[model samples]
Structures are given as structure tokens and as C-alpha cells.
Target: MNAIAFTDVSRSYGNVLAVDGLNLTVETGRTVALLGPNGAGKSTSINMLLGLIRPSGGRIELFGRPPEQAVARGEVGAMLQDGELIPELTVRELVDFVRGLYPEPLDLDAILQMADLTDLAGRRAGKLSGGQSQRVRFALAVAGAPRLLVLDEPTAAMDVESRQRFWAAMRDYAAGGRTVLFATHYLEEADENSDRVIVVARGRVVADGTAAQIKAKAGGHAVRFTLDGQSAAGLDALPGVSAVEVTGGTATLRTADPDATVAALYRGTSLEIRDLRLAGADLEDAFLALTREP
Candidate 1:
């Protein structure tokens, strides 16, 4: 069964539409990333999925049941962007308390180890660092050993080391055949961690595919080289070159066909090319291209 399904789902607040006819599905065991700019309705969609709010129209289902039913049965778990840990509680106390809420919870020790909180189990929630708190939140989210794990900016406020450790733990969790759906602004995380990426803009899905596919959808590779005082004239006429930018003796050619563009750059031009490099569009590039204002 699919882990999640949003069928023509939409949500609105007075005159503002947060999610507009959003339609998508996630298969079980897939690690999917939901990406979008601010005001793109990512949070709203998450809220609706968690039964925190009702959609204005359409339907949502988790494992062939309503979101609320799935959540009530402990089939879903989520770590939202905003939620506070009880300051008086220690890491162990907090995690243990949450795990107790579920019928068949993961072992307390396992939760701590998965979230890298074993070392801080005795630390008070208020005494922990920002990254530590985020870890604690993650531990609570997974305490139920849920079938679907939803995280919104799960690594926010975390340092580089913290981010690394978090992703490792997240991967470990997902390795168990659990479904993961995260919304993050960190494009590289989506590129490296997720099996699929769904980009939403203006309350709608603008792009959906693997990282490479989405990058290709943005349409082109970049061919860069130093001009070495050579004139950039007539470079745009080269095969497959769609856009050309020259700055400080460096030329960047955007082309749909990198092979032809590179060949033309080297053979067709008499200009001395230095530091030539060819690269495909990255996730960030694709994101920008996909989410640009209409």
C-alpha cells in the first residue's frame, strides 16, 4: 500500500490559498523530499497530513486510511518545525514519556542511540544545545517506531557535525523499510539523502523526479573556461549554447548538449581556453529554476 496519498487536496485561510489541488503519493519505504520556497504551503500540507488541520477540499490518506486514523493507530510520526521540549525534563525522561504514549514503542535505549542522545540522556532539556534539542525532537518522533516518519526542516539549527550525525541516524531509521518525507531548504540534503524530490511552488507541485531528472528538467549543463584575454564574440552561435555569461575574463556557457558545446568551445574557437570545466545543474540550480516567480 502507498504510505501517503494526497488527492486534489487544498487548504485556504479566508482569501489566501495555502495548498491548491495538491496531488501526490508516496510508496512505502521511499525516502521522499518535499521542497519549496516560503509561503509554498509545505507547512500547511504537513499540518493537514498530521490531522492538525482540515483541508478545504479533496482527500488525504495514509496507508489507505484517513490521516487521523493512521496517526491514532500509531502508524505515523512527525517532527514539526516548531515544538518545545519540556525544560524540566531530562532527555531520557522526555523520550521515555513520549514512547509510553504508543502501544508498541521502540526500546527507550534504542531511541536514544538512534537519535544520538545516549550520551545526553541525563542532561536536562533546557541545558542542552540547539542541536541537541533537535536530536531530542527526532528521538521523540521515532519513539513509536512508526511506519511513516515526517520531518520538517529536521536539521535546522544544527551545526555541520550535528547535521552529519542526524542524517546518519535518519538513514539508519529509513533502512528499516520505513517511509520518510521531509521538507527542507537544504537542497544538498535532498540531493544526497532522498530517493525522490517533489518541488512545490505557488501552492502546487512544479517539479517531481530524481535529483538528476529534476536538474535536467531545469534544462542544461554549464561549460566554463577562462578567456585568457580572448574576445567572447560569436560564442553564443555555438551549437547547443542557450545562454552565455562573461565576467572578468571567465566565460560560462549554458547548453542543453554539453558534448557538442565543449567540442565547439575547444575546436571551433581559436581563443585560448584555460581552466575548462563542465558540470551539470545542481539541485539548488534546479530548485531556483523551478520555483522562480511566474
Candidate 2:
């Protein structure tokens, strides 16, 4: 069965639509990234899946059951972006408290170790640093031994080292055939960690694919060089070239076939081409290209 499913799902607040006819399905054991700029409905989609809010239209299911039922059965776990831990409890106590609510919780010691909270287990929840607090929340998310994990901006508070350790722990947890869905603004994190990426824009899905495939949708390599006395108008007509921009002595070309564009440049242009460079499009490029207003 699919881990999560949304059929024509939508949510609106007053006159503004937060999510619009979102149709998506997540298979078991896949690490999927939901990516979009701010106010793009990613949080709304996640909230609906978590049962925090009801969809205004269509339906949603988790593990072939209603979201609330799946969550009540301890099959779904989530780490949201907000919420403060109880000030009176230590890290260990907080995790223990949450674990007790589940029917089958993971071993307390194992969860602490996995989340790198072993050192801070005794620290009061209120006294811990932002990064440490985030790790403790991660421990709670997995404490129930949930089959599906959802994280929203899971690494927003972490430093570089903490982010590394967090992803490492997540990798280990996901290795056990558990599905993971995370919403993140960090393009590099999505590119490096997720098996599939879903890009949302203006309350709609604009692109969905693997990292390489998404990048390909933005076109191919970008060729930039200093070419004095060259007109960008002619270069824009070159085979495989999609767009061309010229600024003084420099020119940038977006192309589908970099090799062909380069060959054409060498053969068709008499202007001096110095400091030439070719670079493949990355996730940021794809996002910008796909999300641009039509």
C-alpha cells in the first residue's frame, strides 16, 4: 500500500487558497522531498497529512487508512517546525513521556543514541540549545518506531555539524524500510538525500522527479564567456540554445546541448571567447525555471 495518498486535495482560508487540487502518492520506503518557496502550500499539505487540518475538498489517506486513524495507531510520526518542549522535563524524560503514548515504542537508550542525544539526555528541555532541542524532537518522532516519518524543516536550527549528524541518523533510521517525507528549503539537502523531489509553486505541483531529471527539465549546461563585439541576438538563434543574455563584454547562454552550442560558438562567431566556462544546472536552477510565472 502507498504510505500516503492525496486525491484532489485542497485547503483554503477565507479568500486565499493554500493548497489547490493537490494529487500525490508516496510509496513505502522512499525518501521524498517536498520543496518550494515560502507560501507555496508545502506546510499546508503536510498539515493535512498530519490531520492537523481537514482538506476543504477531496480526500487524504495514510497507510490505506484515514490520517487520524493512522496517527492514532502509531503508524505515522511527525516533527513539525514549531512547538516548545515542556520546560520541566529533561531530554530523556521528554522522550520517555512521548514514547509511553505509543503501543510499541523503541528502546529509550537506542533512540537517544541514534539522535545523538546521549550526551544531552540529562539536560533540561528548556536549557538546551536550539540545535540540541531539535535533536530531542527527532528522538521523539522516532520513539514510536513509526513506519512513516514526516519532518518539516528538520534542520533549520542546526549548525553544520549538527545537520550532518541529523541526516546520518535519519539515513540509518530510513534504512529499515521506513518511508520518509521531509519539507526543506535547502536545495542541496534535497539533492543529496532524497530519492524523489516534488516541487510546488503557487499552490500547485510544478515539477516532480529525481534530482538529475529535475535538473534536466531546467535545460542543460550554462555556458558563460567574455566575448567582446558579439551580438547576443545571433547566438540566441543557435541550435540547442534556449536563451541568451549579453552584458557588455560577457555573454551567458542557456542551452539544451552544451557541446553543440560550444561548437557553434567556435565556428559561427568571430568574437574572442575567453574565460569560457560550462556548468550543469542544479536544483536551484530547476526550481527557478519551473516556478517562474508563465
Mark the 10 consecutive residues where model 1 has the least summed lDDT.
211-220
- For model 1, the stretches where C-alpha displacement exceeds 4 angstroms are 219-222, 230-240, 255-274, 277-288, 292-294
State residue 35's C-alpha deviation in candidate 2, in Å: 0.6
The per-model lDDT (C-alpha) reads 0.90, 0.89
| Clash list (residue pairs), candidate 2 | none
Cα deviation of 122, candidate 2, in Å: 0.4
The C-alpha TM-scores of every prediction are 0.89, 0.85
When summed lDDT is taken over every stretch of 10 residues in candidate 2, the lowest stretch is: 212-221
Tens-place lDDT per residue, model 1, 204-239, is 999899966666666557899988678889999998
lDDT (tens digit, per residue) of candidate 2 on 1-294: 799999999999999999999989999999999988889899999999999999999899999999999999999888999979998899999999999999999999999999998989998998988998899999999999999999998999999999999999998999999999999876678877899989888888888999666666767458999878756668888777888888888898988677788999989877678999987775566667888999
Q: How far does residue 13 in candidate 1 sit from its true spot (Å)?
A: 0.7
Error of 2 at 71 (Å): 0.4
